[model samples]
Target chain A: MNLKAVYIHIGWFQMSVTNLIIVIGMVVLFGLALTLPFPGNSKGNKKGKGRK
Target chain B: MSIMQEKEMWTSKLRKSWQKTLPVEKLLPDTQPAYVASWIYLFGVATLASLGVIIASGIVLAFEGASWYHYSNVGHFINSMHFWSVQFFFVFMVVHLWGKFWMAAWRGRRLLTWITGAVAFVASIATAFTGYLIQTNFDSQWISYEAKDGFNSVGIGSRFNVTNFGQMILLHVAFLPIVLGVITMIHVLMVRAKGVVPPIDAFNAELGERK
Candidate 1:
């Protein structure tokens, strides 16, 4: 029942390190999902070239 | 009114309205627009899949009982599955919300879709909170003790007693899930009705403008 949680303290702001990691991971994943091109799309190049 | 026309009954009116609002063709589309290609689109389905796993594992746990789950190896595994699926569900759902927000998914009269999804997310948080309170462990005890004051400050502590294990269990397993499920179903149906909101670039292209 007395488990220790890793915490990151900066000045007055403090949060569990685990929660901080999860938030950072979500932001990174969202960035990757937005920018990374879907694979196996032969038509993408031909179709995308027409648009800006 | 023609003689052949049947009298206007509530059942027929409801059926006609349902059909008109969600035509069968739109309900089951064979293809999507060319611009539907995006990795972000997968998160919504991923969230739904995690919900399926959570429900399946939860049904097993409910059938086996909490004491059995706490002590039995198989029950422990199922419990872990239920727990992890919930984690995945929230992660995927939040990412889906992010994607929708950036794309301005409420465009083209799809405000209801956005509203329902937002409502479902709030309901899901309530459901998760109740799930935590019903864990029947020291952690749950600590959480309930801490959360009671917050609820009391909001004037709902008497009505929604987090310390009541039986009430928490019913809310987690039954009431909250029903609310979340109904809202989720409406959200998906609205998406189906409106189709995927086109990208902002597509909107600009149609208007002969650039952003």
Candidate 2:
């Protein structure tokens, strides 16, 4: 894929590869966020110590 | 009770109700529970930040008029910021919604909070759809033409004329934004009132201990 080139265009509105990458990156980040455990729930805090 | 005493009783009742539902400590807590220090929790804040940017950039765009973005470099930059902020807002909101759903966030009498958040998400979609129709570009024209059929099939086309630029612009800049804002405010207030839902394991642990 031409990363610098336009990926889609409608009239004057256009989406480039960069835009696609940013959007995909954000989606992936959000997905990854779902799997990560909260700090308080992690094994280190399983005993409920070291928490406010 | 005398009339003056009755009035005082009513005022005190309101004050007590407010304090009971949202104590000052709960409303602005200095510390959050450990489980709240999670990546998923951050998505809600991220969505709020994106909304702030979207609104600020949209204000600038609105002041410059619909066509100014196409003609001026600064306007184009601000417009792009507004566009991307909206994309980020939806992405974050969906992630937050999914995370909450999987966590069963409606537990612990929090169904109202969940419902308010869900309603806010739907309102945000409507706000975004109107925004697309007011973009003043080929995308707007094509989308209006295409969306009209869908609206007509749903029997709402007559009520919402997407082809009418004036109507779309007003909905985009004024009415829909106000609706989204009010809904979002209620969602946040509900969250504050209910407190964050505890993890299921914690609930189970408490139940076991109680037993």
Judged by TM-score, which candidate is best?
1
Error of 2 at A27 (Å): 5.2
How close to the true structure is residue A3 of candidate 2, measured as C-alpha lDDT?
53
List candidate 1 segments past 4 Å from native. A1-3, A40-52, B2-7, B205-210
Chain B TM-score of all predictions, in order?
0.94, 0.92
lDDT of 2 by residue, B54-161 (tens): 999999999989999998999989999998899889888988998899889999999988888998899899899989998899999999999999998888988998
TM-score of 1: 0.89
lDDT of 1 by residue, B39-145 (tens): 99999999999999999999998888766667889988998999889988998999999999999999999999999999999999999899888778888999999
DockQ values per model: 0.42, 0.30
- lDDT, residue B110, model 1: 95
- Reported per model, the fraction of native interface contacts reproduced equals 0.64, 0.44
